[model samples]
Target: MHQCAKEEKVRVIACGAIAREIIAICKANRLGHIDLQCLPAIWHAYPEKITPGVENAIAEARAEGIERIFVGYADCGTGGLLDALCAREGVQRIEGPHCYSFFAGNAAFAENDDDVTSFFLTDFLARQFAAFVIEPLGLDRHPQLKPMYFGNYRKLVYLSQLEDENLKRKAKEAADYLGLEYEYRFTGYGDLTSALTRL
Candidate 1:
């Protein structure tokens, strides 16, 4: 974690999953008064660690005398632990169940039945598929785990935030590897734009 510059008025502790997109949003809107500190994107695979990691970040920010803070995560996989932390700290987080939900627009994503069968990915996951999915899950060595882990998933939906052809191709490859149908949607940061801009 990085220290917030004293000039910064607000600190947004974020998941590294959306770190790049947050930087893009802040840059595009000239939100230079905000400081971003991120936990490892790899933590997305470990929901249990999220709450404590965020709690530490909040303490660090408070130590630096920054009172205006926002958490750039959804409920994520923390059950309600992250929300409880935010409430106790008196801070607000991006409203959504997860990055995929916010990237697709919360209500619209909820209304879609395809989500029940769709495994989701964003640009970050597409780029780090092997590091995050394959090796960590042992899918690289135990290919059989694929069926056991993904048995219920029917499709891999890539909610893209950019028009990068390379990332799209990588996402398609991941879908093929998992034996899931591939669908691409150009979401372009969805609700994240509005949320960060409000900072």
Candidate 2:
């Protein structure tokens, strides 16, 4: 094992989707002692890839002489596997089922059972709606599949990380594309900041 310095900086292995926000938060809070490494954001669609990807990133960070490492991921549809890996690696991760839940405040999100029929999108997801949601889901090539995919989703909830009107418009447009009602909620990084601050 590569030994680290006495004052080694903290390393965060994160999801690419939240990388920008994490950097912004760290900068704003003057948490310059931390470093971030992100895995491909597209892996969000493939939960099976997330655990190994995170493990590899952690190993790389460790090899780079990082003594303290944190994972910036939620369960993210990995079905407890991410948590298991984190435990085995003796690392910590954000608390929630997914980014949307944490951004909404974990406790509050847990209490809001009514949102089960709603689909969610964050700033990154809103920006990459075409590539992430539409193209990968094949809704672009087969518009007819929209109803089948979103039939149970009565509303599209845009969980805004920043107060950007452009992202809001895009999220609304995404809602329209799926034929679902539009709702907006500004979460502003919620628990992510607090979690990072703890480290």
Clashes of each: 0, 0
TM-score of 1: 0.96
lDDT of 1: 0.91
TM-score of each: 0.96, 0.95
The local distance difference test score of each candidate is 0.91, 0.89
Per-residue CA lDDT of candidate 1, range 15-95, in tens?
998988888887778787778999988889998999999999999989989889999999999999999999999999999
RMSD of 2: 3.2
Best by TM-score: 1
TM-score of 2: 0.95
Pairs with backbone N, CA or C atoms under 3 Å apart (clashes), candidate 1: none
Candidate 2: count of backbone clashes, pairs at least 3 residues apart or interchain: 0
The local lDDT score (0 to 100) that residue 82 gets in candidate 2 is 92
Worst 10 residues of 1 by lDDT: 1-10
Per-residue C-alpha lDDT of model 2 across residues 24-123, encoded as one tens digit per residue: 8887777777777788999988889999999898889889888799998999999999999999999999999999999999998899787999999999
* Best candidate, lDDT: 1
